[model samples]
Target: MVMTIGLPTQQKTRNNQLYVEHLSDDIQDHVYQAILEGVYKMFQMFGGSLSEVLADPSKKGKLKDFLDWQIPRLRVQHADLLDVFQGVQFLPLDKHAFLRVQCFVNRLEGRFGEIR
Candidate 1:
């Protein structure tokens, strides 16, 4: 059995063909690609499971640097990264405000098809 994970461009391309039998059209959004790239880099540096990697003796120090430094820096650089993969919740707004935004989104969707 095999497992698949995403990563950044540089790491992903290093041995991309070996991982995929047939590639599809590349993802168009730069943000999504960047997120994938980040995941790839983590996998390369820490292996599969984040907890398992942190538990290893050799990886313990690197884990501290990653948790303390890299994560905060990444959050500053990519504010949406943590939120991107999370489940959605209702906006913190009154009913009227929520309806207004929903109405605007509906209009935009009418004009542009769908968001994606």
Candidate 2:
């Protein structure tokens, strides 16, 4: 099953448009920081940095499996922050999920210029 974390359908508008709610800059930054922290913790648990995992094919596959397993549990643990990642369409189980996840990580790396 493709598990998703999002707001209820009833909360969507009648038009059915994918309207992204605007968050204040401060709140957005806070959410970004929280996500980074969670992702970093995951990397630490895997005993490697993002760059290390990406460079090593074996580790990359392992990370994909690890993320697929962990994301749901993390969602439950961080339920209060679920809205920050609302509208995400990919579950780690999806066929192309790992590529999308890699792209997301690459974007983050670009934005921050380093994993530190």
Q: Give the candidate number with the greatest lDDT.
A: 2
Clashing pairs in 1: 7-36, 7-37, 7-40, 8-37
TM-score of each: 0.29, 0.40
- Looking at model 1, residue 105 earns an lDDT score of 92
- Off-target runs (Cα >4 Å) in candidate 2 are 1-29, 76-78, 81-116
lDDT (Cα) of model 1:
0.55
The clash tally of candidate 1 reads 4
- List per-prediction Cα lDDT, in the order shown: 0.55, 0.60
Score residue 61 of candidate 2 by CA lDDT: 82
Kindly report which residue stretches of model 1 are placed more than 4 angstroms away from their true locations once superposed: 1-90
lDDT of 2 by residue, 29-74 (tens): 4454555567667667765787787778788787777777766565
Q: Which candidate achieves the best TM-score against the true structure?
A: 2
Go through the candidates in order and give the clash count of each.
4, 0
Candidate 2, residue 63: Cα displacement in angstroms equals 0.6
